[model samples]
Target: MIAIVTVLLAFPLGFFLHNRTSAYVVYVAIFGYSFTFQTLYLLRAWVGGDHSAFSADPEKLPLDYLAVTGAIYAVGFLLITLGHRLGAKRRNRSLAVDLESSK
Candidate 1:
């Protein structure tokens, strides 16, 4: 259920920013969500007397999940940055041609 919601969010997060200039927004958001979950998980576990981090308390604080999320975020940033650069190059080329023809 959490995965489903995260996946749904990733699309717009991947799509909307569309450049390295704004890439930090997504990265920050990604880390923020992870931190928020971790904080809540720790609070709940502490309050319930679930001390051991390695214990099977079902809080789902696995390292692999963080790795996967970071990987996805990096790939998304690269793709979006590439798209922005390509679009900018194409636009500049067209504008240059227009300027040359006008001169």
Candidate 2:
């Protein structure tokens, strides 16, 4: 669910910003971290064994889930950054050409 939303937003965000750095900051850092934290919070709640749907009282907090989320977020950031850089370079090149021709 969250993954679908994140993937759907990534391209439009990149296109809307049309700036590599800005896109990365907005999409990867901001949105990515937001979703990650939200998931963690939900997981914590469920782990507390209060939720009827997913009740589980563990002896310790799930550090492994934290590690997995961290790794997934890192990978997502890397992939998004790479794609942003490539798209930005192409768009910038075209803009430069247009500007050069206009002058």
Candidate 3:
């Protein structure tokens, strides 16, 4: 539940700040924190006391949560990289045109 929400929020926030590289760095840091926290939560649930109450067996633990988090991070990072590249290209083209016009 909380993990899902964190992923949802991180993606858009990352995408929105993609124009700047600094924002992408921050996004990755946040994603890392969320991933570590969620992983710890799963480990605690599986290995801590009352584990059987949380899951009938160790194999039943929700490993897919980690996979989902990785996928979201990959997608968000890709989007931010693409956005930065596109922005840089546009800025370069505009500068080129301005230089040509001056010449």
Runs of candidate 3 exceeding 4 Å displacement: 1-24, 35-59, 95-103
* Residue 73's lDDT in candidate 2: 60
Best-to-worst ranking by TM-score: 2, 3, 1
lDDT against true structure, model 1: 0.56
Colliding residue pairs in candidate 1: none
lDDT of 3 by residue, 1-103 (tens): 3346444654455445535667577776777776677667766876766453245466675556557666776777676666666656655664433435553
Q: Pairs clashing in candidate 2?
A: none
Error of 2 at 48 (Å): 8.4
Error of 1 at 13 (Å): 8.6
Cα lDDT listed for each candidate: 0.56, 0.62, 0.61
Tens digit per residue, CA lDDT, model 1, 1-103: 2344345454444455446456556655765676578657865876687765434555667676467656765655565555556656655564433436554
TM-score each candidate.
Answer: 0.42, 0.52, 0.48
Model 3 residue 19 CA deviation in Å: 9.6
**TM-score quality measure for candidate 2:** 0.52
